[model samples]
Target: MNLAEEIQKRRTFGIISHPDAGKTTLTEKLLLFGGAIKTAGAVKSNKIDRHATSDFMEIEKQRGISVATSVMGFNYKDVKINLLDTPGHQDFAEDTYRTLTAVDSVVMVIDCVKGVEIQTEKLMEVCRMRNTPVMVFINKLDREGQDPYDLLDEIEEKLNIQVHPMSWPIGMGKSFQGVYSLYEKKLLLFQASKQKLDDTDTISIENVNDPILNDLLGQSSAAKLREDVELVDGVYSDLDLNAYKNGEVAPVFFGSAVNNFGVRELLDCFINIAPPPLDRETELRQINPTENKFSGFVFKIHANMDPKHRNRIAFVRVCAGIFQRGQNYHHVRLDKNFRFSNATAFMAQSKEIIDEAFPGDIVGLYDTGNLKIGDTLSEGEKGMYKGIPSFSPEIFREVINMDAMKTKQLEKGLMQLMDEGVAQLFTYEMGSRKVVGTVGALQFEVIQHRLKHEYNATCRFAPINLYKACWISSENKKKMDEFVDSKYRHIAQDKDGKRVFMAETKAWLQMVQDNFPEINYHFTSEF
Candidate 1:
């Protein structure tokens, strides 16, 4: 297909939610509909079934929570869908934040019982910042939960976005029967047989009062469905596409992701109405998706996806034009042109080589060591896009290598992990000792675990007793040098060789700021 046609055929989005909201289950069900997987694997299931496709990391499988974002693409109904499944745990917010920069829209999943949550609110804030359109899925309808009306009120009040219910449930919990479609004006009866999840048995009725509907849902459920449909029609009579595209409103669908109920309808409506890949903002100007020049930016970098190969991959979201295999694109950050022959697309842990990809496509390029997150690659115009913002670490720890003989292994593992943006690495006294900083304490556990399991390097972690980390820089180079040199013991260097200072208390940070009035103390390293 031509570039313009190809771009039009692509729909890219990320799945986000609070932990245990069934976000992963919803993702696998969508993938199953797209023919990406034959059978969906249940998350946190016993050893009998394989783990969820998106939770490819061993740590994630073991913990029953996603820690990193997984990109999976598949073709359905003549449309290419790029699904970015992000970690729901607040501890991994950094990974999810970075993944948000790569997608055109988002699917916000909410557990019916939980309503809006902390992580969900935070994620919605980020989406609003970018004006990214969102679709809401009220999952776990099979289980007893809050009233649908109450959940809608919670979403509207907390998220500050109006909701349009595209599908109204017949009954919730064990009394759950099916859903009445608001858009299609039909009643859908659901009976799940996940062993054959790929094949959906559709029972659509035109009349809600039909005897078949009463027989299927029983008289009480059928009457409740009638009442709900009437209320939905009177209140949410119109779905404003413009409001949706502007992120002012979200179209809501209800379902139980595990049983594969009401999922297909959601997917169909999503691809039909979800906005296409939108233009990206850059320093120079807005880059439209149809532009002929090939340009893209790196959002994420992962290491050791293939355990045996130990290869590093840079995930790039194509912003404009077409990307061809073996073509040279200018690396704006390095100010050099590099050609990569090992460009491929992701399917969870698996990858497939492609000859060309379009604007909305995210292609993985092999990186020996040159690529960094937010690096720009373009064939014609060379300019860097806005970089991903890093969050300040909430906890600090000094990493001690148990095996001094494996110093190289320790350094290698730490460097790779840092490059993945998993955590911030710093050193005090000019690299005499190494410390790691993370947004959550669980990250320290993850780092130590990965080092042991993946690198064959065991290490001990000691608390650094630091409250905050600051990146110190100033226009007055001489004064900055004097300040850092005088406090060399307290000063440190980050992975990029940037000067950092570890503050033991809020007073210490304020004192340093007071001393170096001209010096800028930045909490995060901007991409």
Candidate 2:
């Protein structure tokens, strides 16, 4: 197959949801159906052992949670699908933000029972801010959970997004037989199967007629489907389900990903209904490399696992024009230029050498040293894009240096960890140097375990708030100065014989406004 043609017809989306809402399982099945992998790997089993294929980190495998974003691609119906599997945990929400910056759309996965949660809301907000289209998956319906209808209602009420059911599960929980695609108005059933990441022998899609599905197709249900379809059709012509005589939105295929059920139908939905990247709106943002010229954003950076290569890989999204291999691209922030010798398109961990990539494609460039998150690659004069948002570490804990052994090694390891997009590191110089590891509190145990296993560094965590302080200029600074007696404001001389105003926040604001009336004062938060 012509991979570039398929990529031209591709739809790039991120798989996102609350932790353990079956986001990863959905990702595995999509990859399997698309033929990127043969057998879908279970998150619990860690069976395929495709290290760094997606969540290619030791900490992810050991803790059974995704700590960073995983990029993978596959093909369905000759159209390419590039999917980003992001960490669903609130602690690693920053990873999701970076992943969202490059994608055209989102697949918001929700647990049938848990419905909407904190991370789900956060992810939704990011999507909304970007105006990215969304397709929701109420996963795990086969599990013993709440009614799918009730869950749908919750989604509509909470998410403030239209809940258009493309597929309806035949059963709930363990009994989930299959799904009815409302759009195609087809009933898809799955058969038992298993294969490896490279093997392609699992699940197949077939048309089926079950009384449950038939009943859903009856007059009463048909009427409801019509109402829903009209509501959807009236709002967006893109969803013209009226084309389906069955008056359905689309077909919903069901099966247990853990059991390898209903995988094929889901794949069919992606090929049949998901919007291609070219079909989606192009994101217009300020580029550091100049608007009249070409530039791209580095979505991720990774070190090749192969010891021989031992080089850093920079994953970039070309926002405009074509980027060629063996050419120098100005690194705007580094104030330097570097040449990319080998550029290749990626399928998970696999690489296919490619000469060039254009806007809307994600490709990897090799041997770019000192690449960090949010770095822009451009041709022509260097400028800064509105920088990618920095993730604020929510929880803070000091890393106590024990044995004073390998403290330098510990610092070096921490610096390397920062590159992995895992957690932020802060160092404090006490009698002994204290390293503070900041992450979502849920990640503390995992961090400790990794430190013991990966770094072989013994450390203790001290509780801290990571508090930030903010103040109003008028109330705090202006008032303090107005209230301070003039005698206390007598000119204070510094060693340089220069006068300095040793004033509180309130006094500083008052002095600035009184002395410099034309200047406007602004309040800032101190972290």
Candidate 3:
């Protein structure tokens, strides 16, 4: 295929949800439809040792929660779909925010029992800021949950977006039978499988009032669904592709990810309606995907996927053009040109070598500890992408190596973790001691766990009496020097040698801002 044709055939999106909302299960079912995995593995299973494909970390397997973002690509119905599975837990919102920058749309999974939770609200706000389209998947229909109409109303009210029901469930809970498709005017009934994953089922009826549907679902359910269909057709808003693409309306779907019901219908509609590779804003201008030359940006860097080899992989989202292996590209941040001889694509933890990739494709590049988050790479020009922001850490702790003799090892581990964007690492001027800052308390545990398990460097964490971290910059060089020397507040420097202040309370933060009105004390930094 030509460059334009190849770019047009790609669809990129992210999967986001609150914890335990069946996000991972929905991801597995979508992969099954794409033929990426023959048998889907349950996220937390006692009978089978297998875990979900997206949760690849040892810690994730043990905790049965996703802590990092994963990128997986597959071909479904003649279209290349790049699916990014982000952490559902609130602690990993920083990582999820970064992953959102690389995709054109998002599939938000909400539990039917719990409408919209805290993490879902935060994630949806991020998408709203980016004007990224969202598709809602109301999962867990097999189990008892909220009424479908009430759930849809909650989504519309809480998310502040118009909801258009693309597919509606016939009967929920133990009485659940199948889904009634609104667009196709068909009834899809499913049979539960006794195997590890649900087997694909194919039973379609032309009319919602069919006798077979009444037989599959109870007569009352069939009549109720028919009445609901008429109500939706008369009152509910129709599917508006333009409104969806503009992030004003979301097309909602009802399904049971475990039973694999309504999954294929969602996938088929997603690929057809989801937007393709769009323009990305850079410092220079908006870079269109149809551009001939290759351009991309690094949104995430993960270290120690293989603990034995201690490998570092930089995930780059191809934005503008075609990327070919063994081709040199300008590293805009490093101000140097380098070639990636081993450009690989990911299937969760496993990856394979690929010859070329197009726009909206995320390829992993091997790194020897040089790449930083938000670094831009281009084959044509030297310009940086904009709007990748760094969030302020909500917690602070002092890190100490358990063994003083392994200080170098500790430093190495800390450097690698910092480069991976795990958290913000800061150092004071008086001593070699370093402090770690994170947006959530769970990150401190992850940092210590990784240090001991992957690096074999055990460490102790000491909670610090800090409330806020701020980045300080000013045009007056003398004022900046004086502010750095002031002992009124604790001071530190980030990895890039930028000065930062750690305040102990809201009063202290306000005092600093009030005192230094000329200086910029930013809570978050933009790259």
Candidate 4:
């Protein structure tokens, strides 16, 4: 296919929610329905012998939580899909935030019982800020959960997004019969024989009063379904595709992801209404997907994807034109041309070395300590893709190497994990002490686990008494030098070698800001 045709035929999005809301399960079902996998491998539950394909890391498999993002692409009904299943825990918000930038839209999975949780609200904030289109999936319909109307209200109130249900549930918990797809104007019955991601039992229903529903769902369920559909039609407007695309409204669906019930309705409607690869904003100007020149940016970098090799992969979302293997692209940060001999496109467990990829595709470029998060690669364009940033960490701990003999391993692992952008690595200027900073306390545990297992390096974290880590800068070379020289002991260099002021307390930070009016204190590294 030609560039425009190829770009138009792709839908790239991320699946996000609070941990255990069935986000990962929904992702698996999508892949299963897309023909990317057969018979679903495993699940997020730890008791399962095998695990979900998206949770590839050993730690993830063991903990039953995703600590990193997994990019999976597949072809469904002639439309290419790039699905990024991100870590739902708040500890990995940085990774999830960056993944949002890499996709054109999002599929937010919310547990029917829990409604909108903390992490779900936070993820929605990111989507709202980016104006990324979102589709809500109220999962776990097989279990007794909240009232659908209440859940929708909570989603709207907590997430601050208007929603229109494209599919209404037949009933709640055991009473659940199925969902009626408003998008397709069809009634999908959750039949035992049709319990598979790829298939569902459906009957064309031009009218909700169809008698077949009464026979299929029984009197009570059919009556409930009829009442719900009438209320939906009366209270809610139709799924405004334009409004959804603009991120002003979301199309909601009801289903039980674990039972493979009501997923096909989500997928079929998704392919028809969800957006294709859209335009991206770079530092210089907006770049259209149909642009002839290739431009992409690195949003995530994973270390040790394959346990057999120490291979690091940089996940780049192509923003425009085409990216061809063996073709040199300008690395905006490094200011050099780099070519990839082995670039991959993910499909759950399989990594296909594709010859070329169009816009909206996430291409995994194998790297050896060259690319970092937010680095842009383009057709020799100097301007970078904007908005990816490293947040100032809340918790800081001094990392002391226990295994002196494995110092190299420790350093390599630390640097690599820092490059992954889950946490920030800082070196104290006075004692050369290594400090790891993270947004959430859980990241410390994750870092510790990965270091010992993946790097075979042993290290202990010492509590560093500090309030915040602030990146400092100044146009006045003399003022900056003086400030750094005076506070050398409290100064640290970040992963990118940018000087950060390690404030011991809130008062100390305020005093420093008051003292040095010329120096700028930044919470995020993007500035």
TM per candidate comes to 0.96, 0.73, 0.97, 0.97
Per-candidate Cα lDDT values, in order, are: 0.88, 0.60, 0.87, 0.88
lDDT (0-100) at residue 190 of candidate 2? 50
Report the C-alpha lDDT of model 3 over 4-96, residue by residue, as the tens digit: 898889999999999999999889889988989888887897544579989888888888899999999999999999999999988889999
For each predicted model, how many residue pairs clash, with residues at least 3 apart or on different chains?
A: 0, 27, 0, 0
Give residue 141's error in model 2 in angstroms.
2.7
Model 4 lDDT tens row, 1-527: 78988988999999999989998888988988888877665565555556888988877888888889999998899999999999999888999998999999899999998788888988888998989999999999988999999999998899888999988888778777778888788887765423244343667888878788778888888888888888889998767789999999998999988777778889888888899898888888999999999999999998888888888999999999899999999999889999898989997546989899999999999999999999999998899999999888888899999989999999999999999997999999898999999878889888988899899999999998989899999999999999998899999999889999999999989998999999999999999
lDDT, candidate 2, 1-527, per-residue tens? 33344345767778888998878888887776677876656676756574334666677776788876777867677766778899898887877887888887677777777878988988877877766767666676567777666776677677766555555565566555555555556554553344433224222223333335345445554444445445544644555433221212322333455545555556666566554443212233343211335577787766543335555677787665567888888887788888887888877656788887656678887754567767777786564444354443446566776747777755655555556555655432223333343447766665566556566666677875433111213345554455333423322222112222233345554664576443233322111
In angstroms, give how far residue 199 of model 2 lies from its true place: 17
Candidate achieving the largest lDDT: 4
Sequence-dependent TM-score of model 4: 0.97
Output the TM-score of candidate 2.
0.73
lDDT of the structure predicted as candidate 1 = 0.88
| Model 2: lowest-lDDT 10 consecutive positions | 490-499
Model 2 lDDT at residue 385: 44
Supply candidate 3's per-residue lDDT for 403: 90
